[model samples]
Target chain A: MTSPTVFAAVGEVGKDFFKERTTDTLPCQSTDKLFCWDWARENFDRYETPLRQHVELVLISVAIGFAIAFALALLSHRHRWLRPPFLLGTGVLYTIPSIAFFFLLLPLTGRGRDTAIIALSAYTLQIIYRNTIIGLDNVSKSAVEAARGIGMTDRQILWKVEIPLARPEIFAGLQIATVSTVAIATLATFARGGGLGEPIFGGELGIDFKTNIIIAGGLAVLLAAAFGLLLLWLQRLVTPWRRVETE
Target chain B: MSGLLSQLPFASIDGAIEFIFEPQYSNVTGGNKVGGIDKVVELTINQLQVTVISLAIALAVALPFALYLGHKHKFETLAIAFGNAGRGIPELALIAFMAAAIGVGLLNVAIALAVLGIPPILTNTFVGIHQVDRAAVDAARGMGMTEFEILRKVEIPLAIPTLMGGIRGATIAIVATATIAPLAGYETLGDFIINENVYGENGVLAGAILVALLALALELALAGIQRLLTSPGLKPRPA
Candidate 1:
């Protein structure tokens, strides 16, 4: 609630404020300085930091979401009553819409990374929880029986047998979560967590919209593409048997 | 509520309600409005309009291809790949790209929202059609039914529940994400949020609540439809 200060906006940005050069001002569209890429290159810090922040926000949110979802799944597995409630709650949370959820959190947490993470991570829970539960549930009964017959405890059987078998499904959930989280993290700037929203928002704010929008939007897409591939590789490495099974 | 503070005029739950239900009054600074999409009710309608248009276009593009592919048991990879790609791309980026490349308007917002809706419907249509009981389809085929008849009579009825799930999921996503339409230079509930400084804190919170409520209502209403459409025998027992 900084009162939407014109001063602060100017404090960060110069008085020429809006993209100083435009096609209207210039002789030709080609020579338009309003959205010059060279300006973006010169003032790269303004955008680069936001991009990095976007990446880190996604990484942190997903990690936190994974841990929480994993714990919830294990709990619900042990206590049947918790499963339905956990799933239902997370499903409702998922439907809360990221922008609304983030703003709703603004009152309780004010603005920043904490509020952003809370909302972003909630989006991951249903995916992670459902996948983990399915994976663990799908573990072969015979495998568990064999483990028990070998004098292994239930806990040991879960860790040694069920979890390993469930790796692929869990990782699939992670992949989905990672992708969605990265995408959703773009709105974190509005929530005060600072991400790639700078240019997109600034574009709407009538700045050097074309250049800023392209760079910002392009970076966001590239981040998502990179993460999708990264997680796919990681999933493959963790679940090597999956390749054989599919083949 | 930060809006409740003395420094800000529009700062109470009553203020929020009035601000939402009544948009004429304003004490926001500088009179610097963004997008000028005033009125909460107007915003809500705009949000719904954008969502419905997006959904219609998405289903048109995705449903037929998915159904044909599912029935043929071919090119299943296409739907899956599309779904994955859609999941990875943010609506924000898409909207920004559209605004930058194609310029902004209602159509641009719908196009952006359509991208958000397509993946779920495409993947689900393929899966739902595929998941139809093999025995029933075989029996229908043995009864000398045409391929079209078997698909229409046997596969579609059985696949309705799953297909509805896809529709519901897509509808929900689009409805929720449509709130950001204001950012794309289109009128939406997000107008309150994107221009919160002008509307003040209560206006933003009120806008957020309304958006959340709308999305929830859509979710519940769609779930109800899904349940009702599920064949009696196919409906899962409540645990």
Candidate 2:
């Protein structure tokens, strides 16, 4: 059969399947009622609660991960023996499959948000740690020497000089980690507290195509715009000097 | 350091090896023992296959687009915006959408991964090519090279390190993300981990170690590739 004919046949098959499955005990009335914007408006709290929790999970994990990564980066910079293994290990952690990581944690921690947080936090380590190291590495040797010559203590040099200079790279890492954290949190839906993944999975289980498409597509657009704006704001905050330098 | 290391919980390499290779420890779904070495090996290979295929697709699509966007000022802003959007959307959501639209299986997973993998590659490609020394490009053009020739012979070689860096990042991301493939019912190492969790077994720790090992192996391999690609004569030195 031609492609259009094939699609039509598939659509009919899907319709028939839905019809067969439809029963008096079906949850949430008919699928048609669920599609209405008014229905979503009325049940906004149900959706919003999960969305907020997912966001909270992502933010907290990222905050904690960034703190750990920053400390590791500092320690790695000072101790030559620690650098290689630390970099290599974090790189590996960053690369491990999120699902595998979550599952691995799940046995110990069980299902739900905590496991998801730990998994996502582990994933963020490489980006934040590597970027922190790279940012410090990229700091001009002369700057460090100058600080030392001026009698700045090691801690003072790091907090006052190196970190300020490394802010841009750190922000870049934050941008990456934040975006990644948001994306991965959608998988938290698997543990049952529904996020954007709910509709997509619902669609897979033969729920309404339009509903799933709307939820997934709308969420994608919202996330992309929001994060992009966030990066812009962060850039402005961290590197106000950028504007002056360019000007 | 020795005291600290000893104090912390440490699983020996030998223990890991034994757990991975002994048949008695192998627990497949349906309460069957599939044997350890074979199960772990199969799962590793499965993940490797998915990562490589997805990375290949990402590189192929991202490179040319990056080149095109780099050269054309009119399209630059739009290209960057597109990449930013791609970077923002979570891979899990993208995978779910793809699975919903195309139905589940390997191809859907690959396509979803490729989508997730594209932005980094594209952004890096554009940045790499744009950062190619102007003098080199001018000299190439002065030598009567066509636009295509300059890009192929002059710009790309210089940009390879940055491009490779992006590919390295993309490869790592895809390999890590591909672990989620089991969620959609495709059998991968993630299946072993997820299933072990469902059954309340010791396999979870084994699965974690396996994933860690695989990720370490992938990072080493990619670093090796990056080193080879960025050798002295092949690309410009890092500025």
Prediction RMSDs, each to the true structure:
7.2, 6.0
Candidate 2 CAPRI grade: acceptable
Interface quality of candidate 1 as DockQ? 0.32
Superposed model 1: Cα runs more than 4 Å off: A1-45, A202-208, B1-18, B21-25, B29-38
Which candidate gets the maximum TM-score versus the true structure? 1
Candidate 1 structure quality by residue, lDDT tens digits, B1-239: 44554244334455556666554344665554332335666788899899999999999998998889888878777777778778877667677655554546687678788988999999998988987778998999999999999888889889997798789879978988788777667888888877876777767777778889989888899888887877788877888
Residues A1-247, model 2: lDDT tens digits: 1112334444654664465445423343244322334444554454465566666877888998999998898898889689889887776677776656665554356566777788878888988998888898888989999999999999999998899998888888888788777777776655443556655543243333434445554664576468758887987798887789979
Clashing pairs in 1: B3-B11
TM-score of 2: 0.77
Model 1: residue A29 alpha-carbon error in angstroms: 9.1
Query: Model 1, residue A229: displacement in angstroms?
Result: 1.5
Evaluated at residue B207, the lDDT of candidate 2 is 68
Error of 2 at A197 (Å): 5.0
